[model samples]
Target: MDAPTNIQVEVSLGRKKTALLRSLKMPLTLSFPPSPPPTVRDVKRAIQKAFPKFYADRQKLSLPEAPKSLSDDSVLLFDAAGKVELVVGDLGPQISWRTVFIVEYAGPLLIHPLLYHLPTAFYRTEVQHSALQKSIYAMVLVHFIKRELETVFVHRFSHSTMPLFNIFKNSGHYWVLSGLLLAVDAYRPGYSQPVVAGTWRDGPLLQLGWAIWAYAELSNLIVHLNLRSLRPAGTTTRTVPVGYGFSAPFNLSFPNYFFETLAWGAVFLISASPAAALFIAVSFGQMLIWAQKKHRAYKKEFGDKYPRNRKAIVPYII
Candidate 1:
């Protein structure tokens, strides 16, 4: 058979930056320097190159790589003219339901440990990569749901006397997004197959907001800072898989990862039991507290570029 040409990709930076990457009435083909680039190998070869250490990992590798990633997996498609253009990771091959699981597991391995475990890797590696993990998490979480868990266990809208816990509102948004993806897959077996939902337009539209929020957090200040190292100026070069600030002792750290894990658990828990949903709210509280501090710091720094409309951890209110 001839080579398949149906491979598609959608690339965007964000709304304000959309024009930078989006194409109108055309597939999003990219150019290097001035000319269109060359074709490349498939996914298996790409994995071997980027992760020479993980030859075994590549043996039954289920994750997907961009079509072009196989060209030289170590280096993305950069033009010989020396002007960098884009990346396979940025405009990778389309993600599928099975591949989404691999992406989700990567979250716990790549994000949660770093978020709440290691000190050395957190500070040493760029926080942007760490923060991007959230984007990936949100992307993956958009794939699961339980009905009763969504409605019964947690309250979507209400006043929280605790500003720290108020961010559960955002969790609700994420949970809702997860629900939509679940609904889609639950009803439609394959992306090509048809499914039924009775006038269910509301869920997806609301979900877009949550996805945007997830993207926003993916680019936020906390995500920008790598917290892998916890040494003073003169302290020895000690490393831990993860570390928390002295103020944030190990006991305190669980609550953060717990918040993350529970956020996911809440999603799965929404239909099973309220206990998980309650934990979801609790985790929301911890995450909000974490974000509120930085939101305040930025407000103090910008003094003016900051908008009064800004809310720290949640979307609408501060």
Candidate 2:
């Protein structure tokens, strides 16, 4: 089959019509020819070529009618053009991915604790506290705090800037879910019952749940640290992560996600809240999707060197 020819594209930068026409001597319209249709990145490059003053990475190309900026670098120009009018602008401000993660996690860590102290209409009386309830609070707090710390100290993000709106979206997701899980578990009438109440609060089961939670949390931290050590600071390098200790046999593509699910599953088991279990299921589902994407990416990037035996998020099931 014959290869596809490049499609011609005309791009305009910035919003001020009068200012752009008056201040700029060069022609605003520029044509781009890219094989298989150009991406947003190609459009930005064309803009940069026509007008040397504009930075490609800093530019936000969009359809004028759209409410949000066109941020996807991989989107074909032809696909976007059919949807709306193409327009380009300078991205006003940017924040790092690490900062976004920290902020998102911090919201839940801070807001979840307030449910216990704050006078909310949800509880007719002050929510009665128990040793188990207090333990749950401590674990939840530590979980988020650990994530925040890891984002700052351990995780190295390749893409520096995320969509500015994502910070708010992500923060809202974590904050709302954390509150929902904690509130449901803490204030529910069943939680107020003593440990002597049947098999639900059996001593051995509670101990087992705690053990699973601790192991998963610690294992996840180790996996993250090991992954971090693979790539040195101030560099972008890909390395195959070799499992060690408890992780040695699995050869899972994303053991971190697996451990994360286990940690939340442990919490769900301990809390015995259907809502909490549902949240864990939703989270695991999302993580599985991402893990599969990562697995494909690794295969594409490393080819034969990448472990073919590795499953996405599970040892053998997935």
Candidate 3:
């Protein structure tokens, strides 16, 4: 009948049938200030401290009666009539999203040049890499370098961590599909030779591709910088970014994705390789999915304040 002194959260494995009863019987009680109720993250941390095996990333906490996991910042409500039970599901091994990006990008950063210089390692006879191949190599290197720098310094991730197994899956996508496959095809004998064989090393298409690639690369950087400006360093806070460069119209929710797609398209145009084509196709598809989700979040978060005309990853015709 009197005001509650402190809330108690009983931890249990959500999937078990006897979880609720076991939790109530043997509860892992955590004390918190009544002024600010304990958040989901606070509860998870408490559970992790009590059970070392259940780290924050591995813990999916929810009310015993609720079907959905609680958001990290969601405050736990105390019940006067009954026990407060927190269900935790182990999400398996996990790693930081930043680590995942660095590891995956490292694949292409190292593999591209290795395959270019030491073709025999990949079971290909060495042919002198043409100026075009060198040029394409430079572009890909620059692209990945920018990605690494952004991951390390510029971009802020919304999600703190991801499943550990994703490192292999992501690395394979970057290493095998984007790096090795593209390099093998692009650096193959006679694949990148000049149109005039020797004298015209830098063909018109090569020049045009370089121009497009450079423009797209710089545009992508601008968009990234703008996005970074929305969120301060060391925080995941976000705001609607001011338009610049290709995103001047603010028509695309993910203008950076668009620019990267264009940049890869330029790489394909220059190399004229099937691997580059395939990589861009796969990359675009993934980016499109991410963009759609982000777009929906933006609309939901900002409501009518968010632009109604904005597309997900394209200018006007996503």
TM-scores, each model vs. reference: 0.22, 0.72, 0.89
Model 1 weakest lDDT span, ten residues long: 187-196
> What does candidate 1's lDDT look like per residue over 1-318, in tens digits?
432333322222322222313332222243322223332323323333434432322222111333332322223333333322223232222223323333333332333333323433434422322222333334343422222222232222211122222234444444343333332222222211122122222235335534544443333212212232233333333222133211222222222333344334423322222333554566566677776776566567667755555444433432
Greater-TM-score candidate between 2 and 3: 3
**Model 3: per-residue lDDT, tens digit, 90-165?**
6678899999999999988998888788877774566666878888889989999999999998878777899999
In terms of lDDT, which candidate is stronger, 2 or 3? Answer: 3
Off by over 4 Å in 2: 1-57, 60-93, 118-122, 193-199, 245-247
If the candidates were sorted by their lDDT against the true structure, best first, what order would they fall in?
Answer: 3, 2, 1
Leading candidate by TM-score? 3
lDDT of each residue in 207-245, candidate 2, tens digit only:
888899999999899989988888888766778777642
Candidate 3 positional error at 131, Å: 2.3
* Model 3, backbone clash pairs (residues 3+ apart or across chains), number: 0
Error in Å for residue 23 of model 2 = 9.8
RMSD of each: 24.1, 8.2, 3.3
lDDT of 2: 0.70
Q: Per-residue lDDT for 190 in model 1?
A: 21
